[model samples]
Target: MSAQITLNARNLSRRLGRREVIRNISLQLKRGEVLGLLGPNGAGKSTTMQLLSGVLIPHAGQIEICGINLAQEPGRAKACIGYLPEHPPLYRDMRVDDFLLYAAKLHGVARSGLAEALAIAKSRCGLEDTGRKIIGTLSKGYQQRVGIAQAIIHNPDVVILDEPTVGLDPSQIRDIRALIRELGNAHSVILSTHLLGEVENICDRVEIMQRGQLIYGDTSVRMQSLGHQAGFIVTLQSPPEPAELYKVPGVVNVEALSATRFKILHSIDANTAEALLSLSAQQGWQAQQLTPLQGNLEDAFVHITQKQPNQHDQT
Candidate 1:
């Protein structure tokens, strides 16, 4: 069976003051999946998050949370969502336990269910030991944990976190990422951040925005595979002339990198590896390494976001 979709936004557009900030953005999140919203500063990633979480209504488009239309029934739609903004809604003077209880009440957790909800939220967020501590006295990491705990206090179906690890150190970031991964097992997560590494480590799928437009969206595996499909690096015990390698089917260009190593560029639909291996056997060229050039997420992000909108559409 297919996974259930917990959040959906279609043709979402938003404008701030006189400038259009989001343009025809559309995305979906499935239960048990983590979807990262990535973009540079001012790319509208945060804006998109606000739209999805019902914090900011869209100028044009529709949003649904667990099949409830956000525009038509905002309270019901929002009841299914938990949101943690970039700056967590934390009150420094309040005790962790008190703040969480307040949050639980605000989310409409029934009086009868508050105790159980608080316990579950605290346990899931690793706050079982710090409930008595004041929020201001805790480390940045713990503060973030408390922030997350409150968001999930009501056990919403979708969790939206915007820059959840912004000020965290390396260790804290790792812990938070692990927590996010764990959250994905039970909730659809939308992580909005400019940090590429965060997306690579925590997201099952990624959507990249540029100047308020979605430039690319795909599963993390497929996005990374795009680089390998573009070219290959071949090493042979006895080098063949570049022209001979280029003669292989679908091979567009071949460049000799060293005495025995060559780089081959190929057409999009070509299986360069298979063709090269066959040619190596036929020509008696002993193959040492036949590796596809794999592209990292950073490279893919740069290449896609750097293109002009019109140019991108043409390709």
Candidate 2:
């Protein structure tokens, strides 16, 4: 956790016609951190990203990139960010290299630095071989890499990806996840997606939003802890009388499933658990499994999002 803040939004708000799309929101992303933006559909995730990338001017808030105020110094601040929207902006007819060159030129890369710049971007995105291929000819996965290449060609301090793996296959998704992890090691990344697994796999921290408000924001580990309700399930080799198990002091509940298996839910600490195991061992009932169920990121997401009832009268 470095002291440098790559992106910060304070009291951010936006409106679409008469409807408020984003409310008072404050967020910050540290340098070299991957912050996952999570929400259900129409949760203002896209609008937030657009505002940060300078595509949409915020209604009433401040966006700062690497200490530069976006409102006051749009060019200097925006130059430090690379944004990939849900639909990547691509020139289908242009060759990959040509398109990248055009992007580089637009970003003001010097003529002498173009070759090395293209190579770095290509290598990082695994597009070295596809540089000469027409953008439309490549597969979706390759096209995505090209999109990323354009985003990072200028080596921006912050990279924002919106559903970077939306249309890729499972294998392609894995590859993109790896790329996102690698990107975070060098530059701060704000990964926006509704896919819970994507946040679990790559993001160090996550910010869950609902109805334009940030409901949860913390490290993945911390979020998991909030959802953890420690419990264990045990199966025995020999049928155990449910009533007998329930008699144990710390036994919270007992469920008998079949002739040889039952689950004993314990309501005690580790010491009490050991005693129960020993008792099971002496009774000649083979305890098949005793594993603690830890809290996970997915559980936290469900817990937070489900509580916010949708107010949309949208038909």
lDDT of 2 by residue, 16-95 (tens): 99888999889999888999999999999999999989999989999999999999998888889998988888999999
User: Estimated TM-score per prediction?
Assistant: 0.84, 0.91
How many residue pairs clash (N, CA or C atoms closer than 3 angstroms) in each of the candidate models, in the order given?
0, 0
Candidate 2 Cα outliers beyond 4 Å, as residue runs: 256-272, 310-315
Candidate closest to the true structure, highest lDDT: 1
**What value does the lDDT take at residue 103 in candidate 1?**
93
Residue range 225-299, candidate 1, lDDT tens digits: 654447888899987777788788888888888989888889989877898898888888999897777778877
Model 1 bad stretches (over 4 Å) = 237-263, 267-286, 312-315
lDDT for model 1: 0.89
